[model samples]
Target: MKKLLAGTVAGLAMLAIPAQAQAQDAKGAIQVKLLGTAVLPDGKITEVKTDIVGLPAGTQTEANDNVVPTLAIEYFVSPNFSLETICCMTQHDVDAVSGLTGAELVSDAKLIPATVTAKYHFDLGGAKPYVGAGATYFLWVDVDPGEATLPLGVTKTDLSDEFGFVLQAGFDLPVNDSGLAFSVDAKRYFVGTTASWYAGDTLAIQTEHDLDPWVLSAGVAYRF
Candidate 1:
C-alpha cells in the first residue's frame, strides 16, 4: 500500500496536476487555500542513549508549540476522492520541563513537513467532511545548540529526520455560488526522532524523542 501510494504521488507530481474544487464543476477543478496552522509537539526523551553531561534526576523535556502560515492544494480525482498536500515551515525550541526548569536544550530548530494524503469525502449539502491518511517526512533544515548547552561545552546539536504516518480529518463549507469556502483541518502525526549533542569531536548526549505532533489548521479556500 505504501509503494502504491508513493507511486501515485510521484506520478501526480510528474504530471504537474493542479488542485480542483469540490463545489465547482465537480469533475475537474482546482483549489488554493491560505491557512493558519498550529503545531503542538511532544518532545519527551524516551530513552537516554548517551549522556556524558549527566542529566539531573527527574529531568524531562518539552518542545514549544508554534503557529505558522500554510498553503494547501487539493486535486479532486472525484467529488468523493481527492489528494491533498500542504506546504509550510515551522520552528520550535526544546527546554527542560521537570528538574531543570528554564534550561534550554534545543534552539531555533526549523522543520519542513513534506506530506501527501488520500482522502475520502462525504458530501452533505454545501459541506464536505473528509478523512485521510498519509505519509510525512520531517526535514530538519536548521537546528542550533541551546544556550544551556554552551556551558557544557556542547558544540553541535542535531535531530534525525524520519518518515512517519499521519491521520487527518477536515471539513469544507461553501459560502455561495462563487468558488469560496471555509476549511478546518486537523492531523495527528505519529513520529519520533533521535537527538544528539556533540562536544567537539566527542558525543555528549544522545536520546530518542517522541515527536508526535497535533497539527490544526483553519483558512479560506478559493476554487476554480
Candidate 2:
C-alpha cells in the first residue's frame, strides 16, 4: 500500500511540472486578438477652393463616426516588449458644409488604415498595462458623391492616400489560470488628405482635410 501511494504521488508531481512550464512559456509567445472597435472621427476639411456653381471658396467638410470589427497580431520579443500590427477597415460619410448657405452636401468613402506599433508592457500583478506608438498608412477608396451633391454639379471625388502617426494605450486582465485575458485599448491617429472634386472629367475643387480619429476597442487575447 505504501509503495502504491508513493508511485501515485510521483506521477502527479511529474504532471504538475509540465503544466507550470507551459504557463511560463506563454510569456514570449505570439498572440492574436479579435476586437470590436469604435472609430470616432474628428475630421475637418480646410483650404477649400471650388468653382462649382454656388459652392464658393472656404467650404468645409466633416466626417461621421463609424464602428468596425478589427484584428491584431502580436509577437512578444520578451515578457515586457512586443510588436503588434492591427488590421481593420472603416467607412465614413463625408459631408460638405457651406457656411454661406447653411447646407450640408453628403458623400461616402471607405478607409483602410494599416498600423504597426511597438509596445512596452508593465507588470502589475494580475494586470498588464501597455503603451505604444506607431505609424499608419491610410488607403481611401470608393469615394462616391451621392444624389445629394449631383444637383451641385459634382460628379465624383478622389482622395489621396496619406501617412500619419498613432499613439496607443491599453490594459489586459488575466481571466483565469490559462493564457486568456481581457483587453481594452485606445489609439489616436493623426491623419489628413488632399481631395479633388471632379465635374464630368474636369477638376472643380481642391481641398485639404485633417482626418484625426480616435479608436476604442475591447476584446479577448489568447497567448500561445
Candidate 3:
C-alpha cells in the first residue's frame, strides 16, 4: 500500500512541473514603446484662369519631410498573445518644390491604433525575439490647417479631417525577466482628405487627396 501511494505521488508531481512552466511562460504583463516616422507631403491644389478665358501654366507640387512621435501600451494575455494600443502625434511643414517661401503650414493630429495578435519568440539561447500582426483604428483630433499664402488668392485652405485604418507588425527584445524590454514596429496608415481653397470666405477650388503614411517605432517597456 505504501509503495502504491508513493508511486502515485511521484506521478502527480511530475505532471505538475510542466503545468507550472507553462503558467510561468503565459503570465500577463504590461509594456510601453516609442515610435518614429517620416511624414511625406502629398502636395497642394491651385486654381488659375487666363484674363480672356485661357488656362495659366507653371503649376508646381509642394512637398516636405516631417518627423512624427508616438507612444503605445500592450497587454499580454499569454506568452504568445497580446493586445496593443498606440497613440501618436504628427506635425508637417509645407513648401513648394521650387523653394517658394510661404506661410509654413502645420498639422497636429492624434492617432489611436488597437490590435490583437499572436507573437512567436525565437529561443536561440540569447536575446528573446518576437513578431506579431493586427489591425488599427486611427483617429485625428483637432486638425487645424492655416496657410501663409492662399492658393490663387484664396484665404483659407481646408485640409480634410481623416479617420482611417491601418495594418501593423512589430517585434520585441527583452532585456531581462523583470520586464525591461525594447521594441520596434512598422505600420501603414491610409488617409483621405478633401482640400479646398477659399478667398475671404469664398470657395475658389476643391479636390480630394490621399495621404499614405508609413510609421516606424522603437521604445522601451517595463513589465509589471
Candidate 4:
C-alpha cells in the first residue's frame, strides 16, 4: 500500500508542472515604446509641378531636416496580441527662394496617432519578438509662430489634417515578467491642404501632398 501511494503522488506532481507553465503564459501586461527618425521629402506631384498660377520659375523650395519622436503605451490582450496608442512630435523648416530673394519659417507640430493594432508576438525563449499592423488617425497641432515670406506673399501652408496607415516590428528582452522593447515602424500618410497666397488678393488653391513618415524606437514593458 505504501509503494502504490508513492507512485500515485509522483504522477500527480508531473501533471502539476505543465499546468503551472500554462498558467504563466496566459497573463497580460502593459508596455511603453519610444521612436526616432529622420524624414525625407518625396517631392511635388505632376499637378503641383505644372501649376502656372503660383510662384515663378526662379522660386526655390526648401524643406528642413525633419526628426520625429514618438511615445506609445500598449496593452496586451493575450500572449500573442496587443493594442497601442502613440504620441508623435515633429519639427521642420520650409523656405522659398527666388533669384536670391527668399523667406523662411520654422514650424513645430504635435500629433496624436491613435491606433488599435493587432500584434503577433513570437516566443523565442529569452528574447521575444513581434509585428503589428493598423490604421491611425493623426490629430495635428500647429506650434508655429505664423510668420513666412514669398514673392507672391504665399506665407503659409495648412498641413493640419492627415490620416495614415502603420506597420511595425520589434523584440523584447525579459526583465522578470516585464521587459524592454525595441521597435521600428513605417507609416504612409495621405495628407492634403490648401496653399493660400496672402498677397494683394487672397488666392487659395487646394494641393495634395505626401507626409509619409518612418520611425525607430526603444522602451519598457511590464507584465502582470
Write out the backbone clash pairs for model 4. 60-97
Model 2 misses residue 18 by how many Å?
Answer: 18
Error of 3 at 72 (Å): 0.9
What's each prediction's TM-score?
Answer: 0.87, 0.82, 0.68, 0.66
| lDDT computed for candidate 4 | 0.56
lDDT tens per residue, model 2, 12-115: 99999988877786654798888999998866876665555655555666778988899999998878889999889898877756553334344568889999
Sorting all predicted structures by TM-score, with the top scorer first, yields 1, 2, 3, 4
lDDT of 3 by residue, 1-224 (tens): 99999999999999999999888766646766665655554555343321221112443345455676766777777665666776655555444343344544333333333334444545555555566555544344443444544334645555556566565666667788777777777666665556555667766545554555566666776766
Can you list the residue pairs that collide in candidate 3? 35-217, 155-198
Alpha-carbon error at 6 in model 2, in Å?
29
RMSD of each: 11.4, 6.3, 5.0, 4.9
Question: Top model by TM-score, which number?
Answer: 1
Q: What's the CA error at residue 33 for candidate 3, in Å?
A: 2.0
Worst 10 residues of 2 by lDDT: 98-107
Clashes of 3: 2
